[model samples]
Target chain A: MISFFNVSKVYPNGVKALQGVSLQIEKGEFVFIVGPSGAGKSTLIKLIFREELPTKGQIYINGRSILRMKRRDVPYLRRQIGMVFQDFRLLPDRTVYENVAFAMQVVGAKRSEIKKRVPEVLKMVGLEKRMDDYPLQLSGGEQQRTAIARALVNNPSTIIADEPTGNLDINTSWEIMECFQEINDKGTTIIIATHAKEIVDSMRQRVIGLERGKIVRDEHRGVYANATT
Target chain B: MSTGVYMQMLLLRQAYYIFQEVGRSLIRNSLLNFAAVGTTAISLFVLGVGVLLVINTNEIAKTIESDIEIMVYMRHNLAEEDALTLEPLIDNISGVQETTFISRDEALKSLVKQFGDEVEESVGEENPLPDTIKVKISDPREVNKIAAEIEDLPGVESVRYGGQDFVKKLFSLTNWVRIIGLLLITLLGFCGIFLIATTTRLTIFARRREINIMKYVGATDWFVRWPFLLEGIILGFFGALLAVGVLYFSYGALIAKIQETISFLPLVNSSAVLFRIFEGLLAIGIVMGAVGSTFSVRRYLRV
Candidate 1:
């Protein structure tokens, strides 16, 4: 579960990214944060990861105040939340299996555990056959799937994705959404900030609309927009 | 497997990864690494030479300190009794340890022994050398003070210490060398660190995406830091090693040449002094490397 109370973030350049926002994401919920450019979706996602500290508010993940945690404790908080990006940031030189296994390797997981879990996660994301290939050898969807597998390798409680489908086509975006749905079905909360109108409207998951650092509307099982709010 | 054994294997794997990362970055930025190492080596080399010169100077100073004496030459018209009376008065000075008087004949004989038969042949029977009193002082550093006091005495012609005025100048010059060497070392050390920091910063910038990925995947700051720190250490170690190795061989050759040509000059044992100096240089190199990499990486890690 993730909760934010009156969270506000102002960049050093005096850009207000988020302000007076309060929300809660229950366990296993699928959340899509939809907004136009510069609408604080990225900042909201970064806040969840604690990438940027909130200028004025409190945040709790699994009922623990993230604002109170020291710098040393931030990494542990991040461990509970997985992150994906629009660039499909996979190490180009590493093979698919190595890429996924690396996430576990860095956190010092056991070899047997990595060997067993990496293949399992890759299979779930349907990239098991491409394990030997490098990311450059794979298509856009496959690379993004590899990233998903990497994110899931650690079994984080919440997976936060910022524009995961921004670089893909309509079909590829659906495929990535289905992958997130499958993970969501398996009891991991998935939160995505995206500009995909069709995906949000057709899937009709919980949609929160933001405009100029403020949440305008939040609806369960809602489309991207309801006739311009 | 036993838990202890498993933990050991894990540690070994961790060590392997850190080294592999270090090796990878070193090879990846070989040009920059070479430049940093070469630059650091030259600075350390010059610093080492300065240190050796200072060490030799201090050794010469120590030898001179033990034998330091004020040579008091008497006026030629002074009687033997007046010169003898001057010695007792000179000995009354608080710092005077001993006063040995030498007659004109005795001075000529010792000069011939020093300059070979030519000294006696040049003098013939005239014995132009002046009678002298060698005044040994309790403190060699006080030679100037004691010499001035003796110079004022009526029978004494002049008082001389440190062989000639230039030898005293050499001591002061060496003190300047030491001071300048310290300042130069500090400046070079900063440059060495800055160079390493630049190389590592470039590496960090190049591998920035991987760092972002590492951070996202829950890798701790230390997990990212260890490789860069090890890289800095490796760079520093190799640079210092290059410098000290050259210094050792060059110093040995220089010492051998000095012994052959300038036999009068006394030198400290090179091995012990060089060992101590090399140890210090290598340590400085390592610290430069570590601090450089740490400084560069700290900026990016703040994210």
Candidate 2:
């Protein structure tokens, strides 16, 4: 679980990305943070990862104050949470298998451990047959699946993605969402920041809307647009 | 296995992985790597030549310095015996190695011996040359100081040890060579570092996405640093080897062909000295590479 207490972030060049916004995300919840471009959606997610600290306020994850975390503990902090990006960010030269195994290798897992975990995660993402295929050789959905597999390989407690389907078509976007839904069913906390209006409307999950760095709505089973507000 | 041993084993395996990564990167970006290595070799080679020049010039200066003898001329009005008595005073000076008294007639005799008896016939009865003492110094660097002390002595008119201007010129040529050589070498070192750093920065820039993925996946900054550091050292090693190889053989050949022409100038001929220089150049090249990599890779390894 993560909590932000009156967090406000003002960038160095006098840009206010987020201001006085506070929220709590419990364990095993699927939440979508929705907004147009430059609305602090990405900035809020970045604060969770501690990539950029909140300019003023405290953030806590799992009852520990992430705001007070020391610099050397950053890797251990990141290791507990998986991250996916819009770009997929896979090493173009590596195979699907190597790309996933790379995550385990970076955290110093033994070869035997990597060998066992990589295949299991790849199979879970439905990419077991394309283990040796390169990223350029895969479809958009398959590549996103590979990215998800890599994010999941390290067994993070929560998986946060930023615009994961931004580059995909409608069909491909739905498939990627289904992939997230399947992941969510496994009881992992899933937080996605997206601009996909139809997917948010149809999925009917918890939705938090932001406009100009302030959260205006938070509701369970919410629609993309509020019918009455 | 014990825990310590197991940890050591794991670290060894990790080091091997880093080395493999370095090899893969080097081959993956061969053209850019070749350019970095080429610049390192050329800069270090020029540096090696500068060092050798400094060493040889110092040796030449020392040989010439030791051979110089100061002539302390007696006053024209002084009796030859009175001037001869001043030889002990000249010899007593602290840096004065030895002094020999030469009467005017002996000076004339040597001159006559050189120019034949016609010089004695043209001079008639009187020898125009004054009685003088030839003074040798213990340390060439102390010549000016010793000459001043000898000039203040009674019965001494002037000291001529190669004109004052000639000695000043020689000192400038020898002493300034070292300071100038050091400055040039330092500048060349910066050039080599800049080349390596720029090249490594380009490669780091190209693979930034990979680095971002590594950071997101919980890879420590050191895990990313290991490969780049090794790649830099490898580039540096090959460059230094090339420079040392060229300098060693070329210096040996130069000595063989030119030693007789400048027989008195020590010429830095010994293999021991050359090997020492080669070792220094190799060490310098490797340090330059390591420093270059450290500077460029730090910005990309935030985590």
Candidate 3:
């Protein structure tokens, strides 16, 4: 479960990125955070991982306030939430298998667990064939899928995909979404931040839309509502 | 398997992977790594040799000073019984190791042998060298004090032990050698740190993409950190090994030849001193690598 109570972020440069935004998502739910560039979508996701602290209001991940968490404790919180970036964020030198295993390795998963889980997750993301291939060798879609596989290796409670398919073609982007759908069906909570209208319309999930650092819409089955509003 | 056992296996595997990554990175960036190592080895080699010289110089000086003896020249008209009685008194002095009475005749013969046949014949009838009591001090530094005490004794004409001027000059020389050695070591240490830091910084810079990926993927600070630290350790160890090898062989040859030519220098046994230096080099290299990597990575890990 994730909850943000009246959260606001004001960066030191006098930019108030997110203001008085409050929202909650139940466990095992898939949600979309839709916003334009500089609309505070990234800032909200960053808060979940303690990358940036909200200047106002408290953030609770499973009832634990992370706003006051110690610096060292940030890693433990991160271990429970897997994150994927728009760039795929895979180590260039590592093979697909290594990239996925790296997440488990950071959490100190056993060698047997890693060996067992890495291939399983890679197969789930349809990257089993490219397990030996490096990120540079993989296509944008394949790299993003690998990134998704890496995020799931630790079996995190929540998966946060920040523009996970930003660089993929329409079909490949849907395929990446289907992988998320399949992952979601398996009871892992999924939260995605994206600007893709087709993605929001097709997913028919609870959507939280932000405009200029304020939440403009929250719907059980939203449709990039701010653009239409 | 137990949770603890499983956790340990995972940590070890992660550490191994990190070490492997570090090794591959070092090899991939071999040119820079080699530069790091080469600079460190040269600096350590110079530092080790300088320290070795200072240590040995002090040792040899102490040995020489402690072995010195004072000669007390007797009055020409002194009675033999009184001279003989004074011998035991002089021998009983606190730092006096032994006292040998050299008769005027024997002293003349030694002088003759040293100055050659011409001088020997010239002083044959009249003994130019005085009948002296040669007092070997247990500690050479006490020679002047003992000489001063002997000068006031009955039946003693003069005390001919070397004075403070020679000791002052020797001490001054020793001090300068130590200062120079220390200065060189300090300078070399600074240069070594800078070289290793720059090499590590460049390596990390080149791999910034990978580091960024790791950070985004929920990798802990330690998870991202271990590989760089291990890389530094490997570089340091390799450099130290090369330096030790070069220094050991060079010191062995030079010390052997120098000891043979100038036996009085008391050059420390190279084989023995080499082991100590080797240990120090190992410590320095590892610490340098770890510290340098830690320093360079912390800046970019922020944010």
Candidate 4:
């Protein structure tokens, strides 16, 4: 569902984040994009969401060129894809339910639909009982779960998570990974960019490795190899 | 439901959400919003009072101008019949409203009233007061021209009126008052807008994370903008209402006392003037609120 052709990104300060990268991922595939810091993993993910434009090539999502899309159409594109971040960007003042319901409200979902779906999504993340609690009132893992619940409440076709477990303990990281596994099992495509070598090796999914702004390896049922070659 | 009905329902739902967001933010940043509203109220209040002052000053100027009268003194040795003939000539002047002939005897009577019975007895039967034609003009500003025309008329000695310099000074003073009042209102209006804009900018900056989250969730630009715009309008409107209430009671009491003690001073009718000022203040308040928020929130809504 995503294709990048000869994509290159160079910052104004002369740092080349990505250079001549090309890749394709089919729908309904849970893929891991593995790389070290400054290895173009985040830049690749940002390009998919049109957060930053490719400097030298076209990126397509579902047969449409995102590089050619009008500025106003970006929001509709975002609505079809959910995003999770390492920080669990929940409004501290709002309750868990509000945090999740906010996503649906942004898409103008009916009040009834939001009421029906928020609890179901929270249940999937295992936080249904704490829906009334604010983000600050929850543990780190629980807060991450609430963010995941918010991401899922939109019922998007794809989920792009940027280091979703970077701040969590190893145990909490496994739990968050399990939540992603459950979501993937239900047929939503998942793309994760991460540095967690153990989780990457254990998942045994399609892995694309990046090194020095270039994709060094693409393997099916891959292991997280340390060397660039 | 029909499509039109469905659309209306959607609009109503959206309005409810926007207003709910406005209420939430208002409470969230109550202190800042309170200061914004208070500044707006004071600005509008000062503007309203300045407008009323200008209106009343104009009214007073008009009253004074209307009371101006020209005195056409007849020649000292002119016959009584000849002096009476000058009445129609004075009345026919372009600016003259009307002219009344005051006989020597009537002039002597007014003189005696001013100088007492000793003067009356001293001039008994020898009435030395000149026969005069009292002239009222349509416009006080036209007094110099009409007085000059009457001075050249036959059987007239001199034309006398109140201080021309003083009349000119009154007109210039009122003009300056109006100009300065308008300038102050404009300056205060911009000050209020600036304060509101800064307050809104700070509030939006504080909630920028929430806004970023909203953008990531695919909220449309207008969806994000509506609540902030409504917040500004509500603050502005509430401030204006407070100012209007204060102006109505205080100005009414002050005008009442002024009228009681200084009965001759001309003041504009308070109720109608206050009502007009209230409407103007509300309009200015709402516009300032909307405009201030619109400009302040623009830079942060790049998403």
- Candidate that scores best on TM-score: 2
lDDT of predicted model 4: 0.89
Q: Candidate 4 chain B — worst ten consecutive residues by lDDT sum?
A: B268-277
Docking class of 1: medium
Question: What is the TM-score ranking, best to worst?
Answer: 2, 1, 4, 3
Segments in model 2 whose C-alpha atoms lie over 4 Å from true places: B1-6, B73-88, B100-132, B138-145, B151-158
Cα lDDT, model 1, residue B202: 86
The candidate that achieves the highest DockQ relative to the unseen native structure: 1
Question: For every model shown, what is its TM-score relative to the native structure?
Answer: 0.90, 0.90, 0.87, 0.89
Candidate 3: regions farther than 4 A off: A12-14, A110-112, A225-229, B67-69, B87-100, B115-128, B135-146, B300-303
Candidate 1 at residue B96, lDDT?
A: 96
Query: Could you tell me which residue pairs clash in candidate 1?
Result: none
Q: What would the per-residue lDDT of candidate 3 be over residues B1-303, giving only the tens digit for each residue?
A: 998987787688788878778778977998988888898888777877877888888887777676667889889877556777889999878888999988877777787778888987666676666678989888666678888898889889998876768876777888898899889888877777777788899999999877766666656788888888888888888888888888888888888899789876777875666688789887888888888889888976765
Query: Chain A of model 3, TM-score against the native?
Result: 0.97
Model 1 error, position A11 (Å): 0.8
What are the RMSDs of all candidates, in order?
Answer: 3.3, 3.1, 3.3, 3.0
Query: Could you give the CAPRI-style class of model 2?
Result: medium
